[model samples]
Each structure stands twice: as structure tokens, then as C-alpha cells.
Target: MVQLLNSYISLVIERVTMTDEQLVKECVSGSQSAQKKFYDLFAKKMMGVCLRYTNNYEEAQDVLQDGFIKVFNKLPDFESKGSLEGWVRRIMVNTALDAYRKAKKYQKDVDVDSVGFMLDSKDFIVESINADDLLKIIRAIPEGYRVVFNMFAIEGYSHKEIAEQLGVTESTSKSQYSRAKKMLRKILIEKNFVEESERGH
Candidate 1:
């Protein structure tokens, strides 16, 4: 009877839907099951964020684990003023930046590439190269250019915010971003990954 009652209780508990707030509260209260649920909810998206900031799959996995540790430790202090996923995403981004800084990945001086922009970025977007190809090209760029491009163009961070996070001057951030775009444009064009169009634009 006791075992049957316990199983029944567990079944009832499992059927209950949890909002993010409730999941967070349960996690904060030391519920192992709740913590598992919390990790499952955000792990994939967080891993994508980690991958963008890392050079390869293994390093990205390392950053993902480190980011989750910080997330779990600091979660209790998470105020409810903003979306939980946004808060967690910010934590992951900061964790990646910290790892990058520890590895001394910051560039002291990156001159903008002088490649002329023969292709509009908008034109490249409509091509058939696919997302994985795009990611590969982004990863092939130098770390300084890659990081600035990811921050400013993809993450919607202003050059000023990227400058602060990267410990570079705003002009440096802008220069790197411009260099990343021009260099990426040149590579994609040379690779024939983009649609054929007149180059005079």
C-alpha cells in the first residue's frame, strides 16, 4: 500500500505544469528534479550561444559546462524583472567572454581589411549556402574579427557595448567589425558560396 501510494503521488506531481518562475523556485529550494528540468529547458539554446564564442565543439562544450555552473550558482539572485531565458543567455555570454579573456584572445591592434565590398550582405543572405556554411565561414575568421562580428552584428550589441566587453576602444570594435564583414565577403565570393551578381555594387 505504501509503495502504491508513493507511486501515485509521484505520478500526480509529474503531471503538474511548471512555469519558469515556479521551476526557478523549486530549483532554489534544492529540488534535484527541478534542477534537472531547469537545465533541460535552456541547455540547447545556451550551448548554441557558447559555440558561437568558441573555436570548436570541445571548447564550446567546456564553456557550456562552465556557464551552467555559474548559472546554477547565481540563479537565486535572479530578479524577475526580465525574461529568465534572457538573463540566462546574458550569463552565458559573459562566461564566454571571461574564458576568452583568460586565454588572452584580445587583439591589441587589428587594422581594418582594405577589401572593397563587392557584395551586399543582404544579397548573401538570400543565397543557398545554408546556416552551417555561414557558421563555418564566421569561425574561419580571426578571433578578434569573429568576436566583434558576433557581438555587434548577430547579438545586436552596440559597438560601445562590444568595446567594453572586449576591452577594445569603440573605434577598434568598429574597425574589426568592418574588417570581418569585408573579409567574410571576399571569402564567400572566392568560395562561390554566394549568388553570382555584378561586383560593382
Candidate 2:
């Protein structure tokens, strides 16, 4: 899978614009050219989504290739409940979660109370960190925190959905998410993103 996706990445190809329905129809018809074009059109943005759910670039690429394969197989089944990109992203996120579940060791034994250091005030302006920078930071967090945080905070999945998906209790999901937020705040402060009041008072 990795080799296949790597080869796809190495090709110097430009993506062409096509209507979603037309592209989907061509891809579903098993047109190699259309499939390659579909991959080009969505891979970059979808890879970013994959990165947020994985720890590193290689794993992100793994999830990306896996997700794209699913998208191709499932294209004909899509009911257009939402935008094509959004549907693709939903699949990518679920595929990343599957990758996480396979690891089966994301449960952390950390002391969330001690680990939760501080909070960032509104003036902290975390927007200074762009998407890639933020993904790197989030990926550095513990696995449980990363999963819960990405699902609840970024993807806007409810605690119930997260608990069900991750095979944990809702409270566990909520606590891990809270801890993730606190940890993020601590990191941002250390990077000098704290408000003036947080600096000394």
C-alpha cells in the first residue's frame, strides 16, 4: 500500500478540474485516468486530515492511501448527503480512527491533574500556529489525548460518539479531551503565547 501510494506521489502530474458528479462517475466506471485525477484532486487536503489523526508523516500517508482506496471502492455508494470533499474527509477520519484502534494501546495511565498545568487566555492568540504546526503539536501529545482531542475538539464529534468509537466510557473521553486542552495550553504558554496577565499575575 505504501509503495503504491509512494509511486503515485512521485509522479509529476497536474490535477484537472472536473465536476464532482462527473469525476465520481468516471472513477466508478474504473477509468484509470479518472482515478488518478481523483487522487490528485483530493490527496493533499485529505492528507492534512489524516495527519491530524496520526502521529507522523509516514503514518499519515498510510492512512491517506488507505482512505483513498476506501473512497474509490465506496464511491458508487455515496448518497451525496454532503459535499464530496466532506464525505471523503469523513472517510479519512474514520480510517485514521481504525488505524488508532489497531494500535490498541492508546489508553494512558498519566495523572491528568498533574499533567494539566495551565490554561491560555483569549489573548494568547494560538492562531499564530498554522495548520501544519498545530498538527505537529497535537500529534506530539499522548495517543489517548490525541484521539479524543481530534474527535471531540477538531472534528466536533460528541462525547457519546467518541466513547462508542474508541470503546471507552463517555467520561473517559471527556476527561482525555479536557487534559488534551490543558496540555495544549501549557505548550502554547511555554512558546510565549500567554497573555500579559498569565505572564506574572
Candidate 3:
């Protein structure tokens, strides 16, 4: 009985795998049904990516739609070198950066020399805060700083890559990241999420 159940599960998995590949092939061939299936599969995750790059809900939705359009248009180039989802994610990231550049919203120049020192160990107190609250504070940061911070800290982009993508200098990226950290620390401190330590009077 156990063997029969295991065989049944394995067959179900195999059928699902075949269906996914068929869907992709049909989508590449421009089948509307497959396209709908692809959208249903990825829209939620893609929307989360869009939200991270945008300030407001409307802007996020616009970016999401734009990203999906790009994905569909570029589906022919997707040769399965990597996971289709990762390719889609890269497209979304690039689209968000492009939107940022076109809007002239991010800082063009950064004063590297003016970068401040890192906060002290005692000052890094937001570690105790909940993840949701921390995300709220991050979202409150200015668009330029927030994008840089998300790319570098959360999304793991290097300074050089960020600078190249945003059309700024590496030092500028570093400075923005530093400024973001300092601002986050201040915000968290003000919110009493981090306790103040006593120093010598």
C-alpha cells in the first residue's frame, strides 16, 4: 500500500513538471492561455519587486505592468540559461532603475568626503525590532536613499554595480548607503525601538 502511494505521488510530480514546461513553450509561442498562466504564476512575486522600487501604490502598479510587458516581449530571448523567474526578476529590476533615471529623482552627485562614520555598536540597537516595523522604517527613507539601501543591503548589489546602474560614482553609492544607515538608526532611535545607552556624564 505504501509503495503504491509513493508511486502515485511521483507520477503527480512528473505530470506537474511536464505541464510547467509545456506552459512555457506555449507562452513563448504567444499563446494567450499560456500567457495568462504565466502571469498568474508570477504576478504576485513580481509585484513585490515593483513595490520595493516604487514609492506609491499607483507607481508600483505601473512598474509592474511595464515589467510584465517587457517580460512578454523578451520571452523569445529566454533560452533557459537560468531559472525563468530569475530572468524576469532581473528585467523588473532593470525596469525600475530605468524609471528612476527617467524621472531624475535620484541624487546625481554625492559628497564622499562628507560621509560620516559608522554608528557605534551600542547605537546599532534596532536589531531587536520586528521585521515588519523595520521594513516600515526603511520605506520611510527618501526614494534615492531607499533604493540604494535596498539594492546594496537587501538585494546584495555591490557599490560599483549600483553606481553603474544609477549613473553615479562608487563613492556616491557608498555615501548614500552610509547616509541611509545613519538615517535608519536615527529613525529607530526616535521611535524608541532602540534603547539609549548611558555614557559618561
Off by over 4 Å in 1: 1-16, 108-114, 118-124, 196-200
TM-score of each: 0.83, 0.83, 0.75
Encode model 3's per-residue lDDT on 20-41: one tens digit a residue: 4566788988888779979988
**Which digits, one per residue and each the tens of the lDDT, describe model 2 over residues 86-163?**
889889999999999896766855786765455434532467877766777777778889888888877879999999
In candidate 2, how many Å is residue 43 off?
0.7
TM-score of model 1 vs. true structure: 0.83
Clash count, one per candidate = 0, 0, 0
The per-residue C-alpha lDDT of model 2 at residue 117 equals 59
Q: Write the per-residue lDDT of candidate 1 for residues 31-102, one digit (tens) a residue.
A: 999999899999998888888888899989999999999989998998778999999998898898888899
Model 1, position 162, has a per-residue lDDT of 93
Ranking by TM-score: 1, 2, 3
Q: Over the full model, what C-alpha lDDT does candidate 1 score relative to the true structure? A: 0.82
